[model samples]
Target: MTEPASARRITGAGIVLVFVYGVMALAATGRSFVQIVREFDDAPLAYGLSAAAAVVYILATLALMFSRSRAWYRIAWIAVIFELVGVLVVGTLSIVLPELFQHPTVWSLYGSGYVWIPLVLPFCGIWWLRTHRPAAVPELAAAAR
Candidate 1:
């Protein structure tokens, strides 16, 4: 059977988005694991932030992958927006108060460590979520009316 228009949209370019998020999740997880295990004392704040970034990436990837559901779509929005905010806050803090973050994280220096992909990915995610939102189910729409 053929998929509906909404499903196709959700799984179309979204596939690429999912792929990128998946890669980010893996990279962040690996980086954070090494940093935290190797030298938590060297820069607890920076390594902790890296671990948090990994969790956010993992959540975003899962939310996007399961975005066919309305709840998951909203979760995707939350995750992506949170990621953008995190990158901005962490990036600024790392620069303005370098002492606080003795070590660089995935989001440090505006993601300079990762070629700024961390800074740019959230914008792309937000755009994709807005463009490919799943259509409301008729039952839900009727209930809301």
Candidate 2:
């Protein structure tokens, strides 16, 4: 079935999200690698968390790019939600539990090092996915008709 212009536009948003998350994945991976190799003993937990965040970002980006199935939608939702919670929790804990995080993370200080883009991107992704959902489902029904 031919996709409506609206669906195309929404998919474009998802593509944009893929780019954004891909960049984030690169940044987080690079930073984590540097920290892990240069100073693993300094703050294993925080650096490890940074690596984990990078993996999640990569997975979410790929899922958004390659699949528009319900599974991908669910994955995107879960990933974005987890990312939001991760940032908030890690941001707060970094202050409240400074010893556990001797160094920074993508989420540390509410993503302060990254201008809080890390904190905001997930909300955008979720919104885009929600907006695009109807286009995906209805296209199938419209095809049958």
lDDT tens string, model 2, 1-145? 8978764543566767889999998999999999899998988899999998898888878767655677777887788888888888999998899887778998898898999988898888778777766345777889998
On the 0 to 100 scale, the lDDT of residue 92 in model 1 is: 97
Global fold similarity of model 1 (TM-score): 0.92
Cα-based RMSD of the predictions, in order? Answer: 1.7, 3.4
Q: Enumerate residue pairs that collide in model 2.
A: none
Query: Residue-wise lDDT of candidate 1 within 3-113, one digit each (tens)?
Result: 777646556667888898899999999999999999999988899999999999999999998887899999999999999999999999989998987788999998998
lDDT of 1: 0.91
TM-score of each: 0.92, 0.83
Best by lDDT: 1
The lDDT values for all models are 0.91, 0.83
User: What value does the lDDT take at residue 60 in candidate 2?
Assistant: 79
